[model samples]
Target: MINRPETRDLLAEARQVLLDSLVPELGGERKYEALMIANAMGMAIREQEQQEAGEPESTDVMLSRFLAGHALPEESEQGEQTLARALRERVVDGSDRELRAVLRAMTETRLKVNNPGYLK
Candidate 1:
């Protein structure tokens, strides 16, 4: 599991890389910013993998575990909006490197599934 400090360090480094290396090369284009934004999105998704196995359900689990507590909501009531909101809040509020890494991985996973660049 990733502690808070680790997540902060990673985000700091990623921000540096984005500012120092990526931004300059893209000539201040929004598309280049999109790439970095997409990467950070992927990293946030990866944080869920750090959960322990076989733990009993609890409030902490509900808040921290991505897939946890999802069963409570009906299909009609639940959708991408809820998840998206949660994700946005978490990544923005969090300062953890591991969580950011998870977000980055998540972004990659989403890209693999259906990215505009891959359209025929």
Candidate 2:
């Protein structure tokens, strides 16, 4: 059997390399792009860490289950496309308070992963 570093560790190392080695050598738009890449890697590392710590299911999974529980007869299949359409419909209709709450929670969860500084 072979052993390897976890995905989060790999991303962390890659982000560190970008910040410590590559970012210094880059300039102008290239530096900005590299910094953005490093930032994305950091977000991925945080998300992976959250999963490893046994956090709740991802927002997409939770939304899928929510749709399943409230699916219409025409939405029996409950595929990703169907769920997206349903969510959009609910949003536009502006009736389902529960759906609105779920969407808010999902947004916050995504913000926590993507830009925790925004929340602060």
Cα lDDT of model 2 by residue, 1-120, tens digit: 799888888889989999999999999999999999999899898788767765536665666666666753335554445656765666334467766766776777778788889988
| lDDT for predicted candidate 1 compared with the true structure | 0.48
Worst 10 residues of 2 by lDDT: 71-80
lDDT of 2 at 79: 48
Per-residue CA lDDT of model 1 for 1-120, tens digit only, reads: 655566545665776677667666675567576576856644453433223222222323333444344332324544344445656766333554544554555554445434525533
**Best candidate according to lDDT:** 2
lDDT value, residue 46 of candidate 1: 40
What are the models' TM-scores?
Answer: 0.25, 0.68
State candidate 1's TM-score.
0.25
TM-score of 2: 0.68
